[model samples]
Target: MTTLSHSPRHGPTRAVLRLHRVPLWVWTVLVIAGAGGLTWLYALGQEAASYGACGGTGMPECATEMRYWGSEHQSAKLLAWLPCGIAACAGAVLTGRELEHGTATLAWTQSVSPARWLAAKLAVPVVALLGGTTALTLMFRWVWGAGPDGGVNRWNSEYFHAAGSVGPAYVLLGLALGAPAALLTRRTLPAMGLALAGIGLAYHLGDRFRSSLWPASEVRGPWDSALNHVDQLEFGMIMESGERVSGLDCSDQAAPGDLGTCLSDHGAVDFYARIHPTSHYWPIQLVETGIALALAAAAVAAAFWVLRRRLP
Candidate 1:
C-alpha cells in the first residue's frame, strides 16, 4: 500500500503541455497568415494616391501623410485586439472542453497541486497572446516608420499603444470572466458563448470609456481648437485655462479650484477631469490597465477558491 502511493509531481505539467500543443500551432499559423496578411493590406491600402500635398511626386506622398496622420495607429488598434479575441476562444476551449468531455476528473486526479494545475492551463494561451501582440506592435513601428523627431508619441509608440489600448487587460479580463462561467456552466459551447457575449459587452463599455477620455473641445476666444482624437490619451492639456470654457487640466498651471466636485456650462469639464484623475495620459493608461488586470486576477482567484472548496 505504501509503495502504491506514488506522488507524481510532473503529471499535471505534462497534461498541460499536451493541451497547449495545439494552441501553439494555431497561433503560429495566425501570425504568419493572419497578421502577415493584414500588415500587407494595411501597407498597400494606406493613403498613397489620396492625400498628397506634394502632388504624390517628389518624396512618396504615401509615406508622407503616414508620417503625421497615418493609419498605423488604427492598424495597431485592430491588431492589438487579436490577443483578446484569441483569449476568449482559447479560454472557452482551454478547460471548458475538458469539463465537457468528462476529461477534467481524470486531469484532477493526476499528482499535481491545484494551483500548478490551473497555472499550467493558463500559461500556454497567455504566451501565445503575448507573442502575437508583441510582433504586431513591432511591425506597426516598422511599417508606420518614424518621421522627423521620430514622430513618436506615447499614444502612437509601441509602449504607450500597448498600455493605452488595453489589449493585455482585455485578454486577462476574458480569461477571468470566462473561467467562472466555464466552472458554472461546464460545457465548451455554453462557456464559449458566455465568453463571447461578455467580450462583446466589454467592447461597448470600453468604447464609451475611450470616447469619454478626451474632454469635449472648447471654442474659447479665437482658437478653433481641435484636439487630435488619436492623441486623446496623450496631451497633458488641450487648452489653457482662464476662459469661460475649459478643455483639460495642466499640472504646471491652474490656480486650483474648490476641493470637492462642483458643477461650475463648462462644469461638466471639471467633473470629467476629476473622474478621469490622470495627471497625464500615461498615468491614465497605467490606472486603467491596473484596474482591469487587477479585476481579472480577483475573478480568477474567486473561481479557483470556490471550485476547490466546493468540489473537494
Candidate 2:
C-alpha cells in the first residue's frame, strides 16, 4: 500500500498561486511598466535640469516642456491608487469568487483548513504588493530627486505617498479591507463594490486630514513675502494685539496706496501662514503610514474572526 504524506508546508500558498496566477502576472507586468515609465521620465528630468533656466543659453522651450512633463506624468497618481485595485481584486477574485462558486468550501473540506486557506489568500498578495510597491516607490523617489527642486511639490498627495512608506501601507490597507468585505458579502460583485467603497472612503478621509497629522510650521511676514516654497495650510493676518484673523477677513481690495492703512484699521499688522515645510514630509508620512497599517491590522483580524465564526 502507498503511504500518503500529511505535511502542509507551502501547500496552501502554492494552491493560491495556481488559482490567482492571472492577477499575479498582471501585477508583475504593471510594476515593470511603471518602473520603465519612471525611468524614462527620470531621463527627461535630467535633460530638463541640464538646461539651467529659461533665460539661460539652454533651450528656450525647456521650462514649458518640463512643466508639461511634470503635469502629464500620472504614474505616481496611479501608484497611489494601487490599494484600491488590490482591494477590488481581493474581494472579487481571492475570496468572493471562490466562496460564491463553492470553491472555497470545497477547499476547506480537503486537507486545507479554512484558516490556512484564508491566510494563504492574504499572505501571497501581501508579499507581492509590498515588494512591488516598494520597488516602485524607490524608483519614483529616485526620479523625483533627479528633477529640479521646483519641478513638483513634495507635499502633493500622489508624490508624497508614492515616494515614501505610505504607498505600501495603503496597498496593505486595501488588501486588509478587501478580504473582510468578501467574507461578508459572499458574492463577487457585492464584495468588490463594498471593498472599493471602503477604500475610497479611507482615501478621502486620509487626504482630507493628512496635513493635520503632524504639527505645521508657522511663518509671519508681509503679505507679499517669499513664503511660496512651503505647503501653506492656512493664511491669516497677524493682528497688532498678536491675534490672528483669517486672510479673507482682511481683504486686499483696499486702495493700493492705503493698503497698510486699511490693514491697521482692521487691527492687522502682518501676514501669517501655517505651512508644512519639506522637513515635515517624513513625519507626516510616518504618522499616516502608522494609521493605515493599524487599520489594516484591524481589518485582517476581522477577516479571520468572520471566517472562524462561519466555519463549522
Candidate 3:
C-alpha cells in the first residue's frame, strides 16, 4: 500500500517545469539576432552605395543610409509591431492554452493550488516577455543607429519606437489581461478572441481618455489636418479607432487603426501630431505601461476572485 504525501513545493516546481517546456527565449534571441543581422546587411549595402554615390565626400551615401537605418526614430510599422504582435499573441494563450489542453486541472491536482499555478503561469511569460523585449529594444536601438547627437529620428516610421517600448508592455499586459478572460471562458479560441477584443477596446477607450496606456500621439500622419476630422463612431464607444473626413460634416472617409480620434480641423495638412501639450517620452511610456499593468492586475484579481471556488 502506498500513500501520497502533499509536496508543497511541487506546485512551484511543476510550474517551473511547464515554464521551461517552451523555448520562447530561444526564439526571441534568434529573432533579435536575425533583425540585427538584417540591419547590418542593410548597413553594408548603404556603405557600398555611399562609396559609389559620393564623389568628394567619402562614404557620404553610406552616412546617409546609416542615419536613416540607425536612427530607430525611422523604422517601418511592420518591423516595429511584428515583435509586439508575437509577444502579445504568445502570451495571449497563457491560461487559455492550459485549459484547452486539459492540463490546468492536472497541474492543480498534482499538489499545486489554483493561485500558485496561475501566478507561476503568468509570471514566467511576463518575465520572459519584458526581458526579451528590453533586449530586443536595445538591439533595435543600436542597430537602427542613433542620431549623431544620440537622438532618434522620430519621423522615419510612425510605429518603430512606439512599437519598441510599448510592445513589451502590450504583450505582457495583454497576457495579464488575458488570464481572466481565458479562465472565465476556459477555451483557448474563445479566450483569445476575447483577449484581442479586450486589447482593442482597452486601447481604444484608453485613447479617448488620452491615457498613456495607449499612445494616441504616435498615430496620425503627415497628410492630415487639411481634413477636418470629427465624430468618431465606435461600436462600443470604447473608441478603438476613428477616421478623417475632408468635408465640414466629418462623416466621410475613415480609416482603420487602434487608438485614434477625429477632430474638427481645417488647415494645412501637416501631420497627425497633438496640437495639445503632451508628456515627455519617458514619462509617457512609464505612465502608459503602469496604467496598462494596473488594469491587468485588476483583471487578474477579478479572475481569481471570481474563479476561486469554481476550480477543482
Candidate 4:
C-alpha cells in the first residue's frame, strides 16, 4: 500500500506571508518608489549637466544649473531613508500585530510550533528587508555616485547611513529589534514605539561614533581653500608650536592684513582640518555596517531567548 504525504515544507512560511501581505505590498511600493526616485534624479542630473554649456566656472548658466540640481538632489535624498522606514513598519505593523492579537499563539495550536512560527515570521520579513534595502542601496549609490559630487558628500551623516551596506545593515537591525520589541511588549503600538525608539538610539550612537571608526586625514591649509572644505570633521588652526586649536574666528569681516596677525596672536601658524576624503567612504561604510550587523545579530538572539522563556 502506497501512503500519500500531504505535509508541506513551507506551510509556516506561506502562512506568515499570507498573514502579513499588507506589509509585503507596502515594501513593494517602497522599492518601486526608490527606483523611480533614482530614475528621476538621474534625469535631473542629466539636465543639470547639460546646462554646463559655458566654458568657465563662475558663469550664470552654471550657477543656475547648480541651483536646480541642488533642489532635486535634496528631494532625492529622502529616498535614501526609505529602508529604515520600511523596517520600522514591518516590525511594528506586521510582527507586533501578530503577537499583540494572539495570532502567534493561535497558529501554534494549529500544529505550527512556536519556534517554527517565529522563524517563519522573522525569515519572511528579513528576506524582504534584505532584498529591498540592497536594491535601494545599489540604486542610490549609482544615482549619487561612489563619492561626493556637487553637494552630496558620502561622509555626510545622512548620506553615510544611506549610501552603501550601512543603510541595509541599519534596516536589518531594525528588523531584528522589532521582533524582540514585539515579543517583549506583546502589543502593537507599544512594540512599534519601542522599536522606533531603539532604532533611533542606534542611529544616534552610530552617528556619534562614526568618526572614531576610521582615522581622519588632517591637512594644513588656508580655510578658504576648496579642497579642505568637503567632508571636514574638524577645522582648526595649527599653532607654530604644533598645537591644534579649534574654533578660530575667521570671518570675512576680518581686515585682510589684520587676519594674519590675529591668527599669529592666537598661536596659529596655519589653518588645519581633519577630514574624511572620498576614498574613506567605503572603509567607513564597511566598519559601520559591521557594527550594525552585530547589533542585529544580538537583537535576534535576544528575541529568540525571550520567545523561549515566555512560551512553551
Candidate 5:
C-alpha cells in the first residue's frame, strides 16, 4: 500500500498576512497616497519659489498660491504622528482581538508553539511598518528640500521626526509597546487606549529632551552678536570667571545701553548661546533612534514574558 502525505498550505507568517490582509492593504494605500501627495507638493513648492517676489505690487496671485502651499505643508506635518495610529491598531486588532476571541488559543493548538505564534504576530507587522515608514521618510526628505530657503527649519519637530531615521524608530517603538499593552490588557479597547497613552508619553519625553541628547555648541560674544542661525537650546551670561549662568533676566533695562550695564552688574562678561548646528542633525537623530530601539527591545521582551505567563 502506498501512503500520501500533504504539506500544510500556510505557515505562521503567511497566516498572519492572511488574517490581517485588510490592514496590510490599508497601509499600502496610505503609503502610496502619501508618496503621491508629496510629489504634488514638491511641484507646488517649485512653482511658488519661482514667483520672484510674493505679496508685492503686481504679484497678488503669488500671495494666494504661497498661502495655499504653506497650508498644505502644515497639514503634511501631521504625518509625523502616523505611528501613533499604528500603535492603537496593533493593540486593538492584532494581539488583543485575537486573544479576546480565543483565536490565539486555537493557533497554539494547531502545532504552533505560543512563542512562534506571538513572534509571527509581531514580526509581520514590524516588517510592514518599517517598509512603509522608510518610504514615507525618504519622500518627506525629498519634498522638504524643495522648499525655499528659510521657509522651513530642519529642526521643526514635524520635519525633524519625519525626515529621518527617528520616524521609523518611533514606529518600531509603537509596535513594541502595543504588543505588550495588548497582552497585558487582554481587551481590545482598553489595550488600544493603554497603547496610545504609552506612545504619547514616549513622544512627550523624547521631544522634551531631544536637544540634550547631543552636547550643544557654544557661541560667546556680545549679547546681540552671539546669536547664530541655528537651533538655540539655551542662552546664558558668561561671567568674567568663565562660569555660565542661565536665566539672565534683564527686563528692567529700559534702554539698549542699560542692557549692557544690567548684564555687567550681574558679572556678565559676554553672552553665550548653546545651540545645535545643522551638522548635529544626524547625530541627534541617530542617538534618539538608538534610545527608541532600546526601549522597543525591552517592550518586546516584556510581551514575550507576558505570553509565557498566560500560557498553560
Candidate 6:
C-alpha cells in the first residue's frame, strides 16, 4: 500500500483560518475601509483648505472649515473605536464561540494539542490584527502630518492613539485580551461583552491619565493668544507669594480696570500652565504603546495558563 501522510503540518492553522473566515473578512473590510476613508478625507482636506482658511468667520462663511472639522471628527472616531470593536468580535466569535461549541476540545483530541490549538487560534489573528492596524496607523499618520495645518492635534484624546504606533498596540491588546476572556468565560456573548468593557475602560483610563505618562512642560507668562493652541493640563495664576490658584474666579466678571487689582488680591503675579507641546508626541505614544503591549502580553499568558489548566 502506498504510504499516506498522516499529519498535516498546517492543520491547526488551516482549521483556525477555516473557522474564523468571517472575522478575517470583517478585518479585511475594516482595513480597506479605514485606509480608504482616510485617503478620501485627505483628499477632502485639500479641498477644504482651498477655501482659504476661515479664521473668525461666521458659520456660513466657514462651511469648508466646518466640513474639514466634521471629516476629521468622523475619521477620529472611526480610527479610535475600531480596535475595541475588533476586540469584542475576537472575544465573542473567535475564541469564545470556538470553546463554547467544543470545537477546541475536538481539535485537541484530533492531535492538535491544546497549546497548539490556542497558538493557531491566537497567532493568526494577532498577525493579521497587528499588520492591518499598523498599515492603517501609518496611513492615517501620513494623512494627519502631510497637509499644511491639516494635522490632528497630537495630544488630542481621540486622535493621539489612533495616529501613532499606539494604534496597532491597542489592536493587539484587544486580541490578546479576548483570549483570556474567551478561555475564562467559555461563552460567546458574555466574553464579547466583558472584553469590550475591559478594553473600553482601559482606553478611557489611559486617556484620562495620558498627560501624566511623561512630565509635562510648564509655561509661565501672561496668558496670550499663543497659549490657546497648547494642550493645557492645568492653567491658572501664580501668586506674588508663590502660590498657584485656579482661574475659576479670575474672569471677565471683574471690572476691566480692577482686573489687575483683582488678580493681585488673589495674589496672582503671573499666569502659568502645564502643557504638552507637539514635540512630546512621540514620547507619549511610545510610553503608552509599551504599556498596551505589556498588558497584551499578560493577557496572552493568562489565556495560555487557563487553557493548560482546563485541558490537562
Name model 1 segments beyond 4 Å from true. Answer: 1-10, 34-74, 145-165, 210-220, 223-226, 229-279
TM-score of each: 0.65, 0.89, 0.60, 0.86, 0.87, 0.89
Residue 117 in model 4: lDDT: 77
**1-312, model 5: which lDDT tens digit per residue?**
988755443478889999889989988898898888888777776777676546664575576466645755664466778755675567456988888888899988998888888888888888888898888788777776765443466787877788889888888888888888889888888888888888778888998999999999877754452244467787778888989988785657756788679778998877777889888989999999999999989999999999999886
User: In lDDT terms, how accurate is model 5?
Assistant: 0.79
Write down the lDDT of every candidate, Cα atoms only: 0.58, 0.79, 0.56, 0.76, 0.79, 0.77
In candidate 6, which residue pairs get closer than 3 Å at backbone N, Cα or C atoms, i.e. clash? 239-267
After the best TM-score superposition of candidate 5, give how far the Cα of residue 122 lies from its true spot, in angstroms: 1.1
Expressed as tens digits, the lDDT of each residue in 114-219 for candidate 3 is 8887887777777766776666666555554422322333322234334446556666666766777788778777877777777767655544653333334333
Tell me the tens digit of each residue's lDDT in model 4 across 1-312.
999865766889888788778878877887887788777776666666666554567886676567655754564456446567668657766667877777778888988787787778789988998997788767766766621246544566676766678888989898888888888888888888888888889888888888888889987766564663257778878888888888775775366677787787787778878887777778888998999999999998998899899995
RMSD of each: 9.1, 3.1, 10.7, 3.3, 3.3, 2.8
Worst 10 residues of 4 by lDDT: 145-154
Ranking by lDDT: 2, 5, 6, 4, 1, 3
Candidate 4 ranges with C-alpha deviation above 4 Å? 1-7, 53-76, 146-149, 224-229, 253-260
- List residue ranges in candidate 2 displaced over 4 A: 1-6, 56-60, 223-226, 248-262
Residue-level lDDT tens digits of model 2 in 123-143: 998898889889989998888
Model 2 per-residue lDDT at 3: 89
Task: Write the residue-wise lDDT of candidate 6 on 123-225 in tens digits.
Answer: 8988888888778778877776654364345677778767888777887888787888888899988888778888888899889988889899988765565
Worst 10 residues of 3 by lDDT: 230-239
The lDDT, on a scale of 0 to 1, for candidate 6 is 0.77
